[model samples]
Target: MKPSKLLITLLALGVFASLAFGQRRNQIEFYGGAAFPLAPETFKDYTKVGLSGNAQYVLFPSPRLGITFNVGYEAFSTDDEKFTDALSTEFTGQTASYWVGQGFGLSPSATVKSNLLRIGAGVRPYLTDPEANTQFFLLGQVNFNLIKNDFSAKEIPYQYDAVNDQLFFLTFNDEEY
Candidate 1:
C-alpha cells in the first residue's frame, strides 16, 4: 500500500475513535479463529484454511449507540503440489517454450506466504438497553483490506539446452551446462 493511502486510512480510523465513549460503557474485544476459503475453486484447492485474529475497541456515547474500531490479520499457506501444478499448467499453456518444469522442488529455505491486514470501523445500535447488563445490538461496518504475498522460491534451477533439445532442472551438482 502507498504511504498516502495508508495515511488516509489511519486518519479515518482516528476520526472514528475520537467519537466519545460516555456513561462508562466501553469494551475491548479480541478473537482468534480459522479462515475458510469461500470463493474460486482453484484457491480453495491450493491454499489451506488458515489462522485469523482480530482486536476491536467499542465505545458507547449513549445507551443505545456504540462505535467500534478494529484491526485484524489473516494468513493462508499453500499446498505445494497443487500450487505448482496450477502454475505449471498456466505457464505451459502460454508461450513458455523455453520453460519446461512441473515443480520447483522448493527447499525448506524457500519462503511463500499470503497474508492480509484489515482496518475497519462500524456503528452498533442496541436493540435493548445498553445500560443494562444484558444487551443486544446490530452492527454495520466498512473495512479496508490489504493483502501481501511473499514468494521466494530461490533459484528455479532450470536451464534449456538447445543442442540436446531438452531441459535440465533440479540438478544442483551438475555444473556443466
Candidate 2:
C-alpha cells in the first residue's frame, strides 16, 4: 500500500485501540509539521521543504514514565527547475570528444522524489509532579525507516548533429540521495 495510506490505517487502528483501553491515562496523538533543508550545502541546493504527518501512542505505565510508539511519513521532490538550470550552466562553454568540436546544448526535464516511513519506540520521563498542570520531560528514541524513491523521466537520449551544429533533448539521469 502507499505509505500515506498505511499511515492513515495505522492511525485509525490506534484511535480504536485507544478507545478500547477504557478511561486509562494513556493517550493517542496525531501531529504534523514541516521541515526545511539546512546546513549541508548540497542538500539545500536540490530539495524543497516538505510537510510530514505522524501518529503516536503514549502509554503511561507510571506517574512519571511513559512509553511511546510512533509511525510517520514525509516526502520531497527534486528541485527540478533549479537543478536543470545548474546543469545547463555548468555544461556551457564545455566541449567533449563526443561533441565532435561543436558543443551540444542541454534541455532536460525530470521527476526525482524520495519518501520516508519512520517507525520507532521511545521512553519519556516526566520531570514535574504528575499532579502539576504543566510538566517537562526527556525522551529517547530509536527509529527504523522504510524509504522509497520515484526517479523517473520522459525524455530521449541527448542527440546532437555535428555537421549542422544542432542539438536536441538531453538524457535524464537518476540522482540519488
Candidate 3:
C-alpha cells in the first residue's frame, strides 16, 4: 500500500477503536527517561547517551483498557574532546614524530548532534482494577519517527620558519550531514 493510504487506514482504525470502546475517563501524562543506543560496538570511540521525553493523552473506554495518543522528542550529543583524546592515545608517538619532521603543530575540534521526533498511537491494558489508587499496565505502541544528524569540525595547523622569521597558519572547516 502507498504510505499515505497506510497512514489514513491506521488513523481510521484508531478512531474506530476509540469509538467502539466508549470514553469513560481522560488523562494526560508526562514522562522522561535515559536512552541507550542499541549498537555500542559500532560507536566504539565515542560515548553515547541520550534523553527522551513524551506527553501522552489517554482515553479510558473501560476501567481495564485505554487508547493513547503520544508525541515525543529525543536528543543525543557526542563530545569532540573525548574523540580527540581517543585518537591522541592511539597515535601519540606517530603524531609527535610527524609534527617534529614537518616543523608544525596540529589542533582539531569536532561535535556531532542528533535529534528525533516521534508520533504514535497505542493501547494500554490495566492489570489491576481501575478503581485502585495504583495500577499496573502494559503499553503497546506503533510510532513514526523523523530524524536528523549534524557534524562540524575545525582543524588548524601552524608553523614558524627561523630563517625567514615568518609564521604560517592554515585553517580548515568541515560540515557534513
Q: Which stretches of candidate 1 lie over 4 Å from their true place?
A: 1-21, 39-45, 93-111, 131-133, 154-165, 168-177
List TM-score per model, in order: 0.64, 0.63, 0.62
- Provide the global lDDT of candidate 2 against the true structure: 0.68
lDDT of 2 by residue, 102-177 (tens): 4343335555576679999999999998788898999999999776655544332244556976665455445633
Ranking by lDDT: 2, 3, 1
The predicted structure with the larger TM-score, 2 or 3, is: 2
Candidate with best TM-score: 1
Error of 1 at 147 (Å): 0.7
lDDT of 3 by residue, 40-112 (tens): 4535345367899999999887768888999999886665676544443343423323443455444555455
The candidate, 1 or 3, that scores higher on lDDT is 3
Looking at model 3, the pairs that clash are none
Please give the lDDT score at residue 140 for candidate 2: 99
Candidate 1 lDDT: 0.65
Number of backbone collisions per candidate: 0, 0, 0
| Runs off by more than 4 Å, candidate 2 | 1-24, 38-43, 86-107, 156-177
